[model samples]
Target: MLIKWISAAALAGALLASPATAVDLTVWAQTDLSPSASLGPVAEAFTDLYARFQRENPDITLKYEILPGGTEALPNLLTAASVGNLPDVAILDSFWVARLAETGHLQPLNDLWPAAERADVLPAAIDTMTFDGKIYAAMFSNAWRGVFYRTDQAKSLGIDAPPASWDEFLAFADKAKAAGMKPIMIPGADTEVTTLHLISTFWGFGGDLVDATGKPIFFEGANRTALEKTYALYRDLVQRGLLGTEVSTMDEKALRPFFYTGEAAAIANTSSGLQQMYSDAPTLKGNIGVFALPLPDGGRAAPILGGQTWGIFADDDAHKQAAWKLVSFMLQPANLTAIDAAKGYLPVNQAVWAQPFYAGDPLMQQFKGIFDGAKIVKTRPPVPIYPTISSALSQQVAGILNGTLTPTVAVDQARDIVMAEYTRQSAR
Candidate 1:
């Protein structure tokens, strides 16, 4: 009896001293935002980072799913939530933060984040993640759009300076055409691309796309004139053969080869594609330059704020803490730089800004300037209904480019759709 009791006590002690079971965390990341080969740079970087996190936290496991679809990712998340299958963590566009927050699908990070930790991130990033009076997510990978051009082509055309106005841009186009090169690559097939052009042009013409109250005011008075002028620019580009007819069927990806081969003079795209450009043609490394989109009159309109935000969905306390630990691990100095470098995105960690890659690189020199001056377009306002507004507006813009509807008619229809959405949300 004594031997049996001793043996039982020893077994219980060994069990108590053994490691606890790991907490499993599920995360959904947008593959579109971070384009890499299926199991490419981003996947490898994240896998290694997760391993490091696991080493430190032996009791936590991470399972990350790469969700595709650029702008449509929000809908997938919402659908998942509807079925009570929301992941522990979600990576959503910063512009869609309000939509998810207002729907009560996000877990507020304020309570979990210490003030000192919050201060370590960029203020602008935090502002995007904040809804009402509370912070619901942590934003990273800040991005901005720019007028990327082939340096050698521009120099050969005697373009010693970036275009300062609309006339100058058109003049450059004419020169490029005379030089036997396509003036620009326009992603007319992409709704997001069309809307971005509209927003930049509209704002440059001193027109507002949305009012302070987050209502669509795109067709009101001078705003309508602004919209017409933007459309006219597109029509003029198409007429001059500077913007090829093939644009209606081609996306931004289709233009990369054109740019690399010197067939296309310039393209207005975000820095997200810059890394791919370098990889596609190493010879063009020193031949590319980035500039902000200039207004017709003179000055530059702000670039749209582009990036992703990480959120912890409402879940049990253990899950929330485990998810946050993963977030914190990914945000670490080495890990953040590795992932952002692999993905071609600007870092949200303020400390990383001082790193040589961003501070001293010649390629980054141009985009850094644009990022400093970029603004969030009205279509992506910090309101719950912005997703609906952006969707309606983009569809109409695509319609104009596809020739199914005139710009004037498209703008009118879009205005009505947005107004209707606003009214519906108000009543709700």
Candidate 2:
């Protein structure tokens, strides 16, 4: 099993609300996986909000359905839309925004949100959900990948703080290596994790996956340099035995034992993983800390902002209006603040950060700093061929890390495959 850590309340609520005669509004979500487990605070809060919405609008009912995962959810959504059987609203991964809208299955929200309400959201978030000059969805929650280190381990290593730059990180890794601790654990089986780390570093070096025109640009000069540096780091770490060969066979879950047991000093993970760690290993709480991933030379740090959005499906007018209303209500600062605080996620709405929950926690405050300075945050290009592109990139990255393919050759092949897919999708 992939072990999707979802919300317990969402699952309970899903089962508890099966009443008769309710004007059901279908919602497609990935937040209601485990019946006894909670996805996070956001899902719990949404579960409550849905209940409240049903209460207020007695005539309009809502039925929430859970999608399997990002990969399955996207294709299912497209298939449903093509058959004119789309749900009322769907929670979509931010990366699918452009591609979904291009298919004409999503409703434009330009007139739905007022100028003032629109301005309340983080600018980068708003920009990410917008496609071809039209806003198609509302940015809701965000997760950023960064360096998660054990504070006690740093102290034991005679390091007072997390590394502020790539060079410093390398030095820290060397120290951890000397102490017989794995500097970091990279999960090769779960390509998303490794890919995110690699991509963040690429962005730190000023490489971009897409050009200004939203075209694939994987073979550019900046990207080549990024790959070379990444491959060098991999080879050096593996050759020195600082990162074990088992890493190549380890899935996402495989690294958790190492991290929880203190065999690994640090890991690059998203905020969601942070939440899960706190739940699964309460002993590690307070000792864990997050820092922005370092940049090359003396450049500023850049974290990849991963998040989700709420999209209204092209459906009946009544359902569309209800969905929009639900999205607007959820975006309210109070709601966003509570949900983010509970779920350990950064609120996409800027005003939500000013709330007491965010203001009072030092850890959260530090998190906010990373979120504020995240300049390279972007959703993957919204293309129907994204899965293929992702898989190709993952294979190439795995090959580079395992020395099965030269970095140059691997990247070049990835670029060719992605470009071809882009052209094929465009011509359709």
Q: Which ten residues in a row have the lowest lDDT in candidate 1?
A: 31-40
Which residue pairs in candidate 1 collide?
A: none
Which residue pairs does candidate 2 place in steric collision? 6-38, 6-39, 7-37, 7-38, 7-39, 8-37, 8-38, 23-61, 25-61
Query: What digit string (tens of lDDT, one per residue) describes model 2 on residues 1-428?
Result: 23443566667887778545445678788754212126555566676777776777776777778777756777888788788888888878787777788779899899888989988888888887777788988887787776678888899998887788778888888999898888887665546666776666666667667766667766777767776666556666677666676677665567777888888988766776766787789887788877875655555436776577889984667777778777777678887665666667777776887898878777777788876766656655555555665666676656655777777787778888888888887898
Superposed by TM-score, candidate 1 places the C-alpha of residue 73 at a distance from the truth, in angstroms, of 3.3
How many residue pairs collide in each prediction? Answer: 0, 9
Give the per-residue Cα lDDT of candidate 1 at 123: 78
Q: In model 1, which runs have C-alpha deviations exceeding 4 angstroms?
A: 1-18, 32-39, 374-379, 382-388, 395-407, 420-428
TM per model? 0.86, 0.87
Deviation from native of the Cα of residue 66 in model 1, angstroms? 3.4
Task: Determine the C-alpha RMSD for candidate 2 after optimal superposition of all C-alphas.
Answer: 8.4
Error of 1 at 4 (Å): 22
Off by over 4 Å in 2: 1-23, 32-43, 420-428
Write model 1 residue lDDT over 158-267, tens digit each, in one string: 99778877788888889999989888876666466656655776776777767778777778999888877776667667766777767665666877888888888898
